[model samples]
Target: MSFLDATIVNVALRTLAADLRTSLDAIQWVVTAYLLAVAAVIPISGWAARRFGARRTFVAAVVLFTVASALCALAQSSGQLIAFRALQGIGGGLIMPVGQIILARAAGPARLPRVMAVVGVPVVLAPVFGPFAGGVLLDWAQWQWIFLINLPVGAAAALASLRLLSRDEPQASAPLDLPGLVSVCVSMVALTYGLGEMGRDPSATAVLALVAGVSLLGVFVAHSLRAAHPLFDIRLYRDQVFRAASLSSFLLSMGMYAGMVLMPLFFQSVHDTDDLTTAALLVPSSAGAAIATQLSGRATERFGGGRTVFYGALLGVAGGVPFVLIGANTPYPVIATAMLISGAGAGLSVMPAMTTAFRALSPDQIGHAAPQLNMVQRLGGSIATAVLVAVLQNGMDSHEPTQAGTMSAFTVTFGWVLGAAVLAAWTALVLARAQRREPPRVDAPAPAPQSRA
Candidate 1:
C-alpha cells in the first residue's frame, strides 16, 4: 500500500490538478511533500518501534495511513490534500522500517534472504503497477478513488498485523534524543527537499538547503557516535560487511531507479505510446524482477550474495547495452527483452545485499538498519534522477528538436545509466570480497512463536 500510493498519484497529477483547480506546480507538491514527510520521519522510526513495540507501531501506522488516505480523498483543496499527504507520508515512513524490523525478527538472521525476497515482491510490483492502476482508475472513476483505494487495503493489513505479528518485550525506553533527532530530521528534510528542488528549479534556497543538510548530517554523525542510545547506531557502518552491503544497495538504487524514470519517458516520447501503453510495455521489467526474485533465494544460498549480485549486475549492464544505441524505430520486443534482463539483474542483486546486511546486524539493530538503507536508497534515486535529467537536457540542447534528437538525448542519458550499472557491479564485487573474508552465517532453523497480543 505504501509503495503503491507513492507512485500511483503521479499518474493522477494532471487529473488532480484539473479536479482541484490547481496549477501543475502546486499539484507536484502532492508527490514531493509526501516524499519529504517520509524522509523526515524515517530516522525516528527505529526509536518509535523500540519504544512502542513493532506490532503496536505497525498497527498505529496503518491506522494513521488509512485515515490519512480517507482525508486525502475528501480533501476540498490543494492545501488540504498536501497536508493530508504529509500525514500519510509519516504513516508510510513508519510502516516500511517498522515492518522490516518485525519481519527481520520473525525470520531471524538465517532466513532473512528468503524472507526479504518474499517481502520484495510487493515493493517491486507496486511501482510497476502504480501508474497503470492510477491511469485505469482515472479512466473509469473519480480522481478521489486513487486515495480511497488504500482504505480497505490498510484496514486489512492492520487487522492481519494485530493477529499475526509477534510482540517484543519493550526495552527500557529512554527519553527522545532531542538533539540527535532534530539534527537528523533537519538533515533529511533539507537534503530530500533540496534534491527535489534541484530536479525542478535549482534555486538559491535549494542550494542553501543542500549545504545546511550536508553540514547537519556531519553533525548528526558526530553526535550519534558519542551519544548513548543515538537514534541510529552509527557504529553499524564500521563493520566491513555492512558497509559493503549499504554501498552496493545505494549504487544499485541509483542506477535502477534513474533508469526507471528514463524508460517511461522513452516510451511516451520516442515510441509515442499513450500512458496506458507505456505502462503496459514496462510490465516485462517487473515480470522479470518477479521471476528472478523467486530464484534469488536459492541462488544466494548456493552462490553467496556477493557472487550472486556481481553476476546479476553484469547481466543488468548487458541488458542496458541495447538501450544505448536504441532509436525511436526500435521494436517493442527488443526493448522489453532488455528490460527483462535488467530487472532480473536487479532482483538478483538487491535482496541478497539486503539479506547480507541484516545478517550482519543483531535484531535490535534491524530497525535502525532498515531506515538507514532506505534513506540511502531514496537519496540515490533522487540524485540519479537529477543527474540523468540534466544529461538528457544537455544532449537535446546540442541537437535539433527532431526524432533523431530525441534518440540522441536518450542515448546519451543511457551512457550515464550504464556507468551507474558498472559502479553497482564494482560495489557488488566489494560486497563479494567482504563476504569471502567472513562468510554469511546461516543459523539453524528455530521454532516459530505465536503472537502475544
Candidate 2:
C-alpha cells in the first residue's frame, strides 16, 4: 500500500495542481515531501523497534499511515496535503524495512532467501499498479480516493500484525544518537530539496539547500566517527561484501530509475503515442519485474548472489541497447521486449543484493543495516534522476525541435544508463571475488576439545 501510494499521486499531479492552485514546481513538493520524510525516518526504524517493540511499532506505523491517508484525502490545500503525505511517509518508510527485519529474524539465514522472495512480490507490484490505478481513479473519481483505498488494507494489515507478529524481548537499549540523527536529517532534507529543484532555476534557494545538505552530511560523517553508538556504524564499510552490495544496489537503482524516467518520454515524444497508450505499453515491464522478483530470489538462493547479480546486470546492459537504438518508427513489440527484459533484470538483481547484504550482518546489526541500505538506494535514485534529467535536457537542446531530436535525447540519456548498468555488473563481480576470499565467521563456540591424553 505504501509503495502504491508513492506513485499513485504521480498520475494525479495535474489534478492536484489545479485543485491546490499551485504551480508544477510547487506541487512537486507533494512527492518530494513524502520521499524526504521516508528517507529521514528509515534510519530510526531499528531504534523504534527496540524502544517500542517490533509488534507495537509495526502496528503503530500502520495506524499512523492509515490515519495520515485519511488526512491526505481530507486536505484542502497543497501545504496540508504535503504535510499529511510526509506523515504518511514516516509510517510507510518503516514498514518494509521493519517487516524485512522481522522476516529475516524469523527465517534465519537458511530460509531467508525464500522469505525474501515471498515478500518481494508486493514490493514490485505496488509501483507498477500505483500509477495505473491512480490514473483510473482520477479519470473516474477524485484524487482523494487514491489515499482512501489504503484504509481497509492498512486496517487489515494492522490486525494481522497484532496476531502474526512475535514479540522480541527487550535487550539493553543504546542511547539515541541525537546529534548524528539531526545532522543526517539535515543533510538528507537539504540534498533532496536541492536535487528536486534542479532544472528550475540555477539561482534558486534549492541550490542553496543542496549546498547546505552536503555541508550537513559532512558534519554527520565527522560526528559518526566520534559517537559511542552512531545511528549508522560506519564500520560496516569494512565488510567488503557489504560495501560492494551497497554500492551495487545504489548503482542498480540509478540505472533503473534513469531508464524509467526516460521510457515514457521516449514513447510520447518519439512514437507520438498518447498517455493511455504509453501507459499500456509500459505495463508489461513492471509486470515482468514483479513476476521475476520471486524467481530471482529463488535463483539467488540456489545459484548464489554473485551469479544472480552478474546475470541480471548482463541482461540490464543488453536491455539498454534496444532503447538506445530505438527510433521514432520503432515497433511496439520491440519496445515491449526491451522493457520486459530490463524489468526482469532489475528484479533479478534487487532482492538478491538486498538479501545478501543483510545476510552478511548479525541479527542485531539489522536495525542499522535496513535503514542504511534504504538511504543509499534513495540517494542513488535521487542522484540518477538529477543527472539523467540534465543529460536529456542537454541532448534536447542540441537538436531541432522534432520527434527525431527527442529520440536523440532519449538515446543519449539511455547511454548513461547503460554505463551505470556496466558499473553495477562490475560491482557484482567485485562482490563475487570478495565472497570467494572471505571465510565465514562462526559465531557459536567450537565444541570443547575432548580431554587430551
Candidate 3:
C-alpha cells in the first residue's frame, strides 16, 4: 500500500492538474507532500513501537493510512488532496518499519529469510504495478478510486495485524528524546523536500534546504552520540556485517528504484505508448521479482546472504545494459527481457542484504535497527529519484524535440542507472568480504548442507 502510493499517483498527475484547474507545479506537491511526510515520520517508528507496543502502533498506522486514503478520495481540491496525501504518508511510512520490528522480533533469526520474503512483496512489486493500477482505475473509474481502492486493502491489513501480530510489552515509561525527534524529523523533511523539488525544478531554496538538512543530520548524529535513550541507536553500525548490509541496501535501492522510472519513460516517450501499455510492459519485471523473492531466501540460506546478493547484483547490472543502449526503435521483447532480468536482480539482492543484516543481529536489536534501515533505504530512493529525474529533465530541455533526441536523453539517464547498479554489485562483494571477516553472529542461521566433493 505504501509503495503503491509512492508511484501510483504519478500516472494521474496530469489528469489531476486538469481536473483541479491547477498548474503542474502546484499538482506536483501531491507527490512532494506525501514524500516529505513519510520522510518526516519514519525515524519515529521504532520509538512509537517502544512507546505504544508494535501491535498498537502498526494498527494505528494502518487505520491512519486507510482514513487518509479515504480523505484523499473525497478531496475537493488540489490542496485538499495534497494535505490528505501527507496525512496518508505519515501512516504509509510507519507501516513497513514497525511491521518489521514486530515480524523480526517474532520470527527470530532462523525464520527471518522466509519471513522477509513475505514482507518483500509490496516493497518490491508495488512501484512496478503502480502505473498499471492507476491507469486501470482512471480508464475504468475515476481518479479518486486510486486512493479509495486502498480502503478495503488497508482495512483488511489493519484487522489482520490486530488479530495476528503478537503484542509485546510497551515501554510506556521510556522518556521521549524530544530533541532527537525534532532534529531527525526536520532533517528528513527538509532533505526530502529538497530532493523532491530538485527532481521537478531546481531552485535556490532546494539547495538551501539540502544544506540545512545535511547540517541538521550532522547535529542529530552528534546529539545521538551523547543523548541517553536516543531516538535510534546509530551505534548498530559498529557491527561490520550490519554496516555492510546497510550500505548494500542503500546502494542497491538507489539503482533499483531509479531504474523503475527510466523504462516507463522510455516506452512512453520513445515508443509513443499510452500509460497502460507502458505499464503493461512492466509485467515481466514484476513477475520476475515475485519469482526471485520466493527463491532468494533459499539461495541466501544455501550460499550466504553476501554471495547471493553479489550474484543478484550482477544480474541487475546485466539487466541494465539494454537500457543504456536503448533507442527509439529498441525491440519490445528486448525491453521485456531486460525488465525481467533487472527485476529478478532487485528481488534477489534487496531482501538478502536486509535479511543478512537482521540475521547478524539479536532479536532485541531488530527494533533498534529496523527503522534506521528503512530510513536509509528511503533516503536512497529519494536521492536516486532526484538525481535521475533531474538528469532526464535537463537532458530533455537541452535536446532537440525529436524521437532520436528523446531516446538519447533516456539512454544517457539510464547510463547513470547502470552505473548505480554496478556500484551496488561492488558493495555486495564488499558485503561478502565483510560477512567473512565477522565472527559468527549469535543469531546465525543453520549451516548449509555440505556439498559432495
Candidate achieving the largest lDDT:
3
Model 1, range 1-453, lDDT digits (tens) per residue? 887787677556656777899754456567656766776667667667777877898899999999999999999999999999989998987887777766655565566668778877765656567777876776678889888899889989999998888777666566677888788777866776676566456789989989999999999989888887676777879988889989988888776666566776677557666556666777887887888878888888899878888888888889888989777888888889998998888878877777777666655455567767776666565466555655565566678878888888889889888988988898888888998997665552211111111
Alpha-carbon RMSD, candidate 1: 4.2
Q: Each model's TM-score, in the order given?
A: 0.85, 0.85, 0.89
Order of the predicted models by lDDT, top scorer first:
3, 1, 2
Q: Residues 180-239, candidate 3, lDDT per residue (tens digit)?
A: 878887887788678766755779998999999999999999998998778778888999
After superposition, the stretches of candidate 2 with alpha carbons farther than 4 Å from their true spots are 14-28, 76-79, 163-172, 196-207, 259-278, 362-364, 385-409, 439-453
- How close to the true structure is residue 196 of candidate 2, measured as C-alpha lDDT? 55
Q: Which consecutive 10 residues in model 3 have the weakest lDDT in total?
A: 444-453
Structural RMSD, model 3? 5.3
RMSD (Cα, Å) for all candidates, in order, is 4.2, 5.9, 5.3
The TM-score that candidate 1 achieves is 0.85
What is the Cα-based lDDT of residue 17 in candidate 3?
Answer: 74
Runs of candidate 3 with Cα error greater than 4 angstroms are 13-29, 76-80, 159-169, 193-203, 439-453
lDDT of candidate 2 over 352-371, digit per residue (tens): 77777776766555556667
Residue 300 miss distance in model 1 (angstroms):
1.2
Q: Model 3 Cα displacement at 342 (Å)? A: 0.6
Residue 109, candidate 3: Cα error in Å is 2.5
- Supply candidate 2's per-residue lDDT for 320: 79
Q: How accurate is candidate 3 locally (lDDT)?
A: 0.78
